[model samples]
Target chain A: MPHDTAAHDTAARDTAARDTALPGAVAPGTAAGPAPVPAAADDGEQSLARLEAGLDALESAAVSDRRPWWRIVLSRLLPPAVALAAIVLVWDVLVWAHVRSGEIMLPGPGDVWNSLVAEWGPSRIGAAVWDSVYRAAIGFTASVLIGTVLGLLIARIAPLRAAVQPLLSGLQNLPSVAWVPIGIIWFGVSPATIYTVVLLGAVPSIAVGLIDGLDRVPPIYLRVGRNLGARGLDSVRFVLIPAALPGYVSGMKQGWAFAWRSLMAAELIAISPQLGPGVGQVMKFAQENLDLPLALGSIIIILIIGIGINQLFFAPLERRLLRTRGLSRS
Target chain B: MTLTIDEAAQARTLTETAVRLTGVTKRFGKQTGTPVLDGIDLAVAPGEFVCLLGASGCGKSTLLNLIAGLDPVSSGSIEVSGGRAALMFQESALFPWLTAAGNIELALRLRGVDKARRRTEAERLLRLVRLEGAAKKRAHELSGGMRQRVALARALAQQAAVLLMDEPFAALDAITRDVLHGELTALWQETGVTVLFVTHNVREAVRLGQRVVMLSSRPGRVAREWRVDIPQPRRIEDADVAELAREITDELHREITRHGRVGVDKGASGHAS
Candidate 1:
């Protein structure tokens, strides 16, 4: 402890000395004579002192700081696991007390679990899940392409932006299910109808996100970009897009949610036999048969998939982008 | 006519001038706006280091921007000798997305340097700023001084004969700013790039510039010029630099008082309250 105190004293003394000497320390030979050689020598000495200080900063930062890996993992995983356990406990108690209805009416956690594991096989439920996921993926990919183009156009062209920006916002507020009626009238109960609904749900969110992102790009960045000889497309590609990426990624995440919700709504309402029973369709079928456990099982699957895609893809992508800019915690 | 003769003379003088601004006037808008720079004419010679010293709102940065082609002169011409000059701002201005070396390489890339040579050239520039080891560090990770050093290196990579700096070291702490001054002086000697540095710090201007030009605000105009004959590698605290800075500070105060229309202190002398 004495040694530690002594070391701390020395470090404090060095800092105090550096603070006073930094600007006040005149070139060594200037006292005896106003010689340029001595002045240059003095600069060399000051530079060496600064370099040593910088190296010390870097070294200390590296040595004294480290977060344990296990602690980080525990912090990330513990909360969600506890939440799931609590939900299950509450469900079991409700069913045991016969809170609402019989097993046919409100299924217990065990009944739902049984229906998930015992009744639905990979042959039926797996394909249904895949069908829903595939539909969402295709629709989202198309929205990303088309919406990005639309957003960029809206951002750059003032007249078009004025014409379409309010409309885009209006479209985003309109429920995706509302689009199903129009879609059915236009395309019937086909894949195309599902796509139309998904696009209707997703495209405005993505496009509006992009337009907001582009607007939020700092004007200083654009000025520096142009000054560095980045002209026209080069400026947008290098300066504008990278600066706007955080907003863009969030927009994409929102768009994905919209696409998934719209696809589920479309599958439930349209009921296309050609397109294979999706997760939504399975839930609807279960409801028609009064199979509460199966319906609850399908709902759980949908929720899991939604959470999985975000945790696996969008969250990581957003974190990496923000971390590079030092906008997020490591 | 007289205009043609003036143009011929201007063309003749263009060879030696790294930057030439002839009667440059800048107004932000056509409606009820005072001109920022009013008929300003300045010519910087090749390889010379000049500091533009003025108070805040003096349009020093506006002038630098005009010279760098970032903004157009309202009714006059600005010739950079080269196509465009490189400019550095007080805020390090390095792209946060790029690492130290990546920032430098970007400038080189825009200047059409071959892809294979950009890395080595960027390394050399980083070495010149004594930041070679920080090549992989992002702008936020480095210290304030280090970020400015990288920005300087990026400006150097532009390969322009003229460099415009708008208070590029004003944000640093005293120690870091002093260290950067030394480094900048050394770099200027080694590279021989013509530097037009803008700052309000009188001691800094005396310590760094071969020629110091003072500007007055409220529609900025060049007020006075001084040739600094003090020897190179001058410290900010040096006796001669302090003396010159005191003189400039007095003149700057007078310039400020001239703009105060309401507080008409006719007999206050050098001490304006």
Candidate 2:
């Protein structure tokens, strides 16, 4: 009983001395007294090991360790919206101040808003955006799908990848607007013509993007995937597809821009009522009538649609992908 | 004591053996006089943790690649009792596009697990690796250890009874590497999967393996073997582990420093204490 009591008292004294001597609980006897210090350090070493184990437990990243769902949604939505609002407010102020001819060259926010409303009106562009949307969606969807298929066909098969690699690169650099003439010859003065223009313009972007993405995938991933018993289509779908999605998405974004521009260009050059009215056709009619607000309005609407799609759709998707990988933020 | 397992022994623990490489030889056959591995003979029993320790030119990776079925053996044959073996590399090599969970789920999908089951399996493996909450985390988002754990989960999702690890911890820092060693050791014990670990670090071999196999430096051969009898939860700095590593280090250094130079081992006594 005396021995136990003595050991307990010694431990209490040792712990108190340790607390007094060290910073944040390293044994005080370590630095103070040399004799019995090694003995003290044995305790310190054991404690240090416990501390290390605790740190491992504390710092380890858990798989379910995600922020709540709505928080993620808000975190993603807030930044882009703030930027968009800032831009809109600045434009409104500049136009209200007549900084760049609210009436002429840099039409004010109200003027742009008026154009937005007027265009979407029963007679004007309410119907027009739907046309552009349809054409844009169709063109973008088709190009994304077709270009991905083409890119995969080119990337995987050695002979095909080699043969079409240069062809794809060359196609990317060559402007799709240049293909308008060829498109006109093939599918002239109709919806087919506009769709053709969009196709020619957008397909290359998607295909080229997919190719680059595929090329960027590290060879180690393939080796590991193969070892994991994933092969052929299984490899491509699970490994290649997911691995290449970021690049593929970027390609889709670029292809969208091309398709939109191409459709507008086609509509402006060759107008037909059966072809459906779009921003381009509306802009053409407005310009002809000398209605500058309406013309400028149509242009603004197109820009807004593009901006909205990028900010609302693709930007969030990209952020989510990058953030999930812990690539974007620590 | 006995490496061989008899029929009754096999029946009692009837799990499939991990890997068997017989006369395994990998030869480029271009200008190099000999093949990478010459008549390599090796076998790993079920749930056995084996480490292949060799110097750089020994083609240890090539041997692993063959066992993994990533490359065909030039001469010998590799047999695994399970369906196939999954490989993990030095680089975590997690797919950048997918989240940590998504990456594991893809492995499940390829294994033809149902979509609903994949998420649960992925989550379960993540928990096994102590990365239970990092399901949505991406590759770069993780610290080195975290990424490795996620990758380990992904590798495990393949459901292969054999795991071929090619120096998977060579890139980590001392502290992170230590933690990972514990995690790996624990997981290996729990899973009962055979591990064929190839590494250059002698201490790492001592720390992780139940059996350590050393290959000769140039155009690798089975140089020596050590059966580790130390208890688990080992650290690299453990006196026994360090002592074994030192002995193997002498052999490894001798093989690495001299190419058949007759007994001029003057540097042995002069090494770090």
TM-score of each: 0.87, 0.77
Please, what are the lDDT tens digits per residue for candidate 2 over residues B1-273? Answer: 354557657654335456878888888645367678888898888878999999998999988888888777778788886658888999999887778898898888888899999988887787666566568767776777778888899889999889889999999888888867876875776677789999999999999998999998667889999998887656789999999999999999988866545336554544524
lDDT over C-alpha atoms for residue A128 of model 2: 83
lDDT of model 2 at position B261: 50
> Using lDDT as the measure, which candidate wins?
1
| lDDT, each prediction | 0.83, 0.77
Candidate 2 per-residue lDDT over residues A1-330, each given as its tens digit: 233343345446544654575443243221211223243445433343343335444454353466888997798779978998898898778767767544456666677567667557676688888888898898888888888888878877899877777877787677666766776788777777777778888888888888888888878888877876678888887788877887888888888888887877777777777787888888899889877778778877788888788878887787776665565653
Tens digit of lDDT per residue, candidate 1, span A1-330? 243243345445544544665443422221222223433434354444455345426532642365798997798889999999999999899889888754445679989988888766777788899889998999999999999999999999999988999999999999888988888899888888899999989999899989988998888888888889999888988899998988899999999999998888888899968878799999998989988999999989989998899999999899888877878866
| lDDT for predicted candidate 1 compared with the true structure | 0.83
The candidate maximizing TM-score is: 1
Residues B1-273, candidate 1: write the lDDT tens digits: 999999998777766898888888888867356688888888898878999999987899999988888887888888886778889999988898889999999899988999999999998787667666678888877778878889999999999898999999999888788878877876776666889999999999999998999988968888999988887757889999999999999999988877774347664556745
Name the 10 consecutive residues with the lowest summed lDDT in model 2 chain B.
B260-269
Would you list the clashing residue pairs of candidate 1?
A: none
